[model samples]
Structures are given as structure tokens and as C-alpha cells.
Target: MNLSDSRRASIAWLFLCFAWGTGFVAAREGVKYAPPFLFAGLRVLGAGLLLLVICLLTKAKLPNRRQLATLLTMGAVIEGFTNICIAFAVFYLTSGMLSLMLATTPFWMVGIESLKPQGDRLSSRHTVGLAIGFTGMVGLLAPKLIGVSYNSHLLMGCLVMQGACVSISFGSLYVRHQRLGVAPFMGAAWQMISAGVIVVLVGTLRGEWVRWHFTPQVAKPFFYLLLIPSMLGYSCYVYCLPRIPLALFSLHRYINTVVTFLLGWLILGEKFGVGECFAVVVIFTGVFLVQNSSFTVSKKEPSS
Candidate 1:
């Protein structure tokens, strides 16, 4: 690549990291002023609309009925379940805690996958890693469970986020199973828009509309989320995916967690105590072993 092209790619990578890393913090801040469901519903809907516009401009192919049906179902699990739970979860949990909790998703995915008759058999090390991950997860929530300054709402939020992780696992597996060969961007756009509509309708029924207010405090983070992570960051992902290895691309997940934890501490003043530190190390160590044992090299997905 030429110098100018290389410079633009570098810029995109930096912004992509910044945008994705701070996403949970933005959601947490936004929902403080607006109802959680409405905040999340509108955020996804706006991003979906903008992404659809870009896809159309680029002449991405549309899905037929069967593909549309599969996409919509994936959306129900991915967007509908995950987004709703996340909105409510962040209402109670610190964004950093939420991010750390999300790092356990691969554990849940393996458990879910093992239920299938054709599932990959796990090694002794893999089984031990899963156990360790679960132990760390329980430790992370031990204060609430043990009633050491426990909060019922915070416990509930943590549970809800777990539910979201399950949703994400199932949704990812479902997408892999379908193997529909729909253009990635086009498929994501349709799924997002469909799920956005469903969530917004449900939120309206819950009277979240009455709770929503367009104050300056909310508008900044709300728009930042819609424009940055959901739209531009994803655009950057599409751009970078082909140019980089899949393993390198997936490192964004780890980067996002560390960046989010640090930013939550700096910007939101979220506590990171001795217990949290110990739990974080154990959880990631478990994750490392689990991911390493489970690793199957994947080719970079085509952006279009």
C-alpha cells in the first residue's frame, strides 16, 4: 500500500479500537437519562438505517425469503435478546464489570456446542479450563451471593448479562450453521433493522417512551454510540478484516475488554479492587487455555 493508504488504515484501526472499547460505557451513560430499552432500541435502529444506506450505495445484494427468514431469526437472538438484556444489565452493573463478564462467552459457547451429537470432544485440559472459568465467574459475583453488601438489582443485572451471553453464543452458532453465503454487511444490516423494530415496539409497549427525554446529557453519548461503534467502527471492521489475519482481527475482543476496563476506571470512576483484580486474572487465564485448546484456524471473511 502507498503511504497515504497506509496512514488512513492506521487511523481507522485507532478509531475502531476507541469506538468498540468504549461502547458499553456509552450505553451505560446514555441509559441514565433515557429508559434503557428505548435507548438501546433507538441506537441499533439508527445504526441499522445508516448502514443500510451505505450498503445500498455499494450495491450489496438483497436476501431472498429463506435467507431473510434465517437472518431475522438470528437477529431475534443476537439483537433482540442480547441488546434488551444488556440495556437493563448496564442500568445496574458498572460497564467495566459488564465487559469482563462478557469475556466468558466462549465458555458458554462450548457448553452449548457440546450438547450437539456432532459436537467436538473436549480434552481433559479443556474441561479443566471450563471449570476454572466458571469458578472465577462465581467469585466475581460472590459478594452479591454472600450478601456482603449485596444488591438484588446488581445480582439481577449480572444474571441478565449472562442471558445475553447465552443469546450471543446461540446466535453465533446459528449463523455458522446456516452458512447462507449472504453478504456479511447486507446480512448484518437486515438482521439489525429487523431486531431494532421488534425491540422498539416492545419498549414502546413497556412505556419506555414516556421515560425517554432528549436532554443534552443523553444526546452526546447516544449519538456517539449510534454513529461511532455501531456504524463507523463496523465499517472499519469490514475494511480491515480482509487486510489482516482472522486471529489478529479477533484480538479486538481482548483489546476491547482491557480498554473498556481502563476507561471505565478513568471516566466513570468504577472501582477495581483486589478481589476484582484476582478474578480478572483467573478468568482470562481460563479463557486463554480454553481458546487455545479450542482453536480452529479460520479464513478472513469477505467484507461484501
Candidate 2:
């Protein structure tokens, strides 16, 4: 790529990182004031609608009817579960903690890939990285398992959040493996739309509206989520992927992980104790090893 192309890619990547990192902060704040499902529901729903409008105006290549079911299922699993898990878990877990846990997604992706018949082989470095990361994860979970610092509710949220990560990993792998003949933006539009509708219907069924009362205070975070993370963040990601290399794009998780931790501490005043300090160091070490282990890696996830 030329100098101008490189500059544009860097800017897009930074914006994508900012959008992803701040998204957790926004979600945590929104859930605190609004109904978890509804707040999440509206954010994704609005983003999906906007993307759909863009696709229509641009005359973008869209997925055919036969592909809708698969795309929608992928969306419901990836975005749908991600939104629901974050919404429910924020009541118990801080956004910083959420980001810390989620940094293990690469590990989950590896595990899922291992189960596939035609999965690629991993080097010794990859195994070592996985082991180290698992050690850090066990430390993180020890409090909940031994009932030292967390209660049943907190533990349950952790499990649910992890489950959502697994769901996202599996869905992402399936979509990439199938090589669905759809444009990235078009497929993503349907995925987000389906996910939003499902969450809204579930929220409505649960009478979450009764508990939700929209106010100006909630609007700030909600709008940020709708426009910045859900919409613009994704736009940057898809734009950057074809322009940049996968290795560079992989830096996104690390950057956003730190961003979430720093913002959570600075803005939300979430606690950052010795344990958090240790986890950050240890987990990143493992992730770095895994990422640089010379193993073939997939592209960035379509979901934010």
C-alpha cells in the first residue's frame, strides 16, 4: 500500500479500536440506568437499520433469500448473544472485568478450531500460550469457584458471558468456513437486524419495558453505542480488513482491551487492584505468544 493508503488505514484502525473499547463503557453505563435487554435491543436495532439503509442507497451486493436463514442464525448467535450477555452481566461485573475476560476469545477460537476435522495444526508455542492463558483464566475464576470474592449471581453471570463468547467464536468459524457468498456489509446488516429483533422480542416478552423509562441520562450512552460502536466501529473494521493485513488487524483486541481497562478505571471508577494488574500482564503474555506462534490465524470477527 502507498503512504496515503497506510495513513488512512491507521486512522480507521484507531477509530475502530476506540469504538470497540468505549462500547463496553457505554453498555455498562446504559444497563445501569436502563433495562439491560431494551437498552441493548435498541442500540443494535438502530445500528442495523442504519446499515440497511446504506446498503439500499449504495446498491450493495446483498445475500439472497436462501442465505438469509444462515446469516440470521449467525447474527442471532454472535450479536444477539453478545448483547444479551453484556447487558445481563454488567449488573454484576464491571466493564473492565468484562474486557479482561473477553480477551480470551482467541483461546476459545483455537478450541473450536481444534474440534473441526480439517483444522490446522498448532505449534509448541501455541500450546504453551494456551496453557499460560488458561492458568490466568483459572486465577480469574478461582474467586467465583471457591466462593472467596464472588457470589452465586456473579458466578452465573461469568458463565453466561463465557457462553456468549463461545457462541460467537463458533458462529464466526462456521460463517468463514462456509464461505457464504455475500458481501461483508450486507451479511453483517442482516445479522445485526436479526439479532436486534430477537433481543427486542425477548425483552418485550419479559416485560423489560415496565422497568425501562427512557431519560436524557440514558440517551448519552445509548446513542454512543448505537452510532459509534454498533455502526461506525463495524464500518471501520470492514473497511480496514481488505485494506490492511490480518496480523495488523489482530492488534485491535489488545488495544481495545487496554482501552476498556483504562477507561473503566478513569471514567467508571472501577477497581483495579493487584489481581487485576497480575491478570492483565499474564493474560497478555499468553495472547502475545499465541498470536505470534506462527499458526495460521483467521481474520477479525465481523461482529463487534
TM per candidate:
0.89, 0.92
Candidate 2 residues 193-213, lDDT tens each? 989988887799889999888
**lDDT computed for candidate 1:** 0.81
C-alpha lDDT of residue 48 in model 1: 85
- The TM-score of predicted model 1 comes to 0.89
| Tens digit of per-residue lDDT, candidate 1, span 1-304 | 7788766766777777788899998987887788888888888888888888888999999888999888888786688888888877887889887887687888888778776666666766678889888888888788767746778887898889889889888887776667787898888788888778777877899998887888999899989999989988988887777765555566676678888989898988888888987887888877776776753323355789
Find the candidate with the highest lDDT and give its number: 2
**Highest TM-score, which number?**
2
Question: How far off is residue 136 in model 1, in Å?
Answer: 1.6
Q: Name the regions of candidate 2 deviating beyond 4 angstroms.
A: 143-150, 296-304
